[model samples]
Target: MPTLHELPGLAGQRLGPTQWREMTQERVNAFADVTEDHNYIHVDPERAKASPFGRTIAHGYLGVALLAPISQQLLAVEDATGVNYGMDRLRFPAPLPVGERFRGTAEVAEVTEIKGGMQVKVTLEIEVDGQERPALVADCLFRYYA
Candidate 1:
């Protein structure tokens, strides 16, 4: 974690290609149950095997939702609390096939002072193991307050 005073200087710094995590079928199913998005492409391997992807894939939003935990591994401000502000932009460039390993990498794009806090824009990418393209890319904003 960086101190509040040091935060401003972190712009353009690259954070981790975090430890790899698998996108399991059970996790996909759980997300499907919670979001009520049981699209066969996400939850049904047999059916999805017939689709172009040739196997079940994770819902795009599931990767979006994973950003929270993934970001934790990349950033935190010392002696301050942070909250998600929003995303400036988001794109799923490639599907995250189920059972594949993925990890996050982040670059601190910009940091600015806010009225009672600081705001940072971090460009985050989730990459799938063995895939050339990333599963998701986002310019995510966050606010930190002491």
Candidate 2:
């Protein structure tokens, strides 16, 4: 992993592609339970099978949920203290269908060193199955401190 200092200079640079295991129905159902989003499109495979995408489709938020593991793979930070400062301009343009292999690209957008920590903002572009339209786009903010 590149050092945090190296990251600032890489602003607007697309990080390497980091993939996640295919989003599964079981996982989706689990998220629905956790988030209380039991929408048929996301939970009912039989019903979702009749939708435009066909088969159970993943929840839009689920796309965002994939960020942590993917980001962990991209940034090898040697620190234990990191906090999510929040996100900006998050959008889910397309649905990620179940069983599709997904990946994310993180581009450094901005960084600022504050009294408490370093504020890092990254534009996360997540996609599935090499599709032209990204499944999700989010400007994520995170803070890290030694």
Candidate 3:
């Protein structure tokens, strides 16, 4: 992990395509249950089988939510506490079909000074294993306090 002070110097640094994680039906169902987003394409396998994707798909927001844990593996400030600031941009270029494997990668896009902290913008991508397009791509912001 890099310290908060080192953030500015690490701009443009590319981080890991972390360990693959499977998108299971159980996981999707849990996310749907919590978010009250039980969309048929996400929770109904039989109905989803008739959709273009051929099976249930994970919600796009689920991929966004995953950035929390995924970013931990990619970037961390050893002596600072980090909080999500917001996202400048987000896109789901490909559907994340349940049962598919995915992983995350990040790049330090920018860093700027702020009161008692540094604001960092990271470009994160959640890629489906063996797929040509990423399931999620976002410019995520964070505030790291010393």
Candidate 4:
């Protein structure tokens, strides 16, 4: 974890590979219920088998939603107010198959001084276990107020 004082100088630093987290069917179903996005490819295993993936997969947004928590393991700045500014680009190039484990890696692309703090641009990557391609990639902006 980097300290608040260290944030500015930490630009271009590579943080993560956080501990792997398994994607379980229960979590996928819960996400589906919350978002009301019970797509067959995401929630119905039997039906998905007939589709290309051969099994149910997780929603892309679920991978995005996990970024903050996953990045927490990579970076922590206390005594600061942080807000998710947004993402410049996001992609789910590969499927996140159910029951597979995934992890995230973060890189501080840029950090610039703002009115009361700094705006950090982070490139976050979520990789599935035993897979060559990342499940998700996002270029995110975060404003941290000191």
Scanning candidate 3 in windows of ten residues, the lowest lDDT window is 71-80
Residue-wise lDDT of candidate 4 within 79-125, one digit each (tens)?
Answer: 67788899999999999999999999999999988989888999999
Question: How would you encode candidate 1's per-residue C-alpha lDDT over 1-146 as one tens digit per residue?
Answer: 78877899999999998999999999999999999999999999999999999999999999989999888888977788889999999999999999999999999999999988899999999999999999999999999898
User: lDDT values of the candidates?
Assistant: 0.94, 0.79, 0.95, 0.89
TM-score of 3: 0.98
Candidate No. with top lDDT: 3
TM-score of each: 0.98, 0.89, 0.98, 0.96
lDDT of 3 by residue, 30-86 (tens): 999999999999999999999999999999999999999999888889999999999
lDDT of 4 at 36: 98
Rank by lDDT, descending? Answer: 3, 1, 4, 2
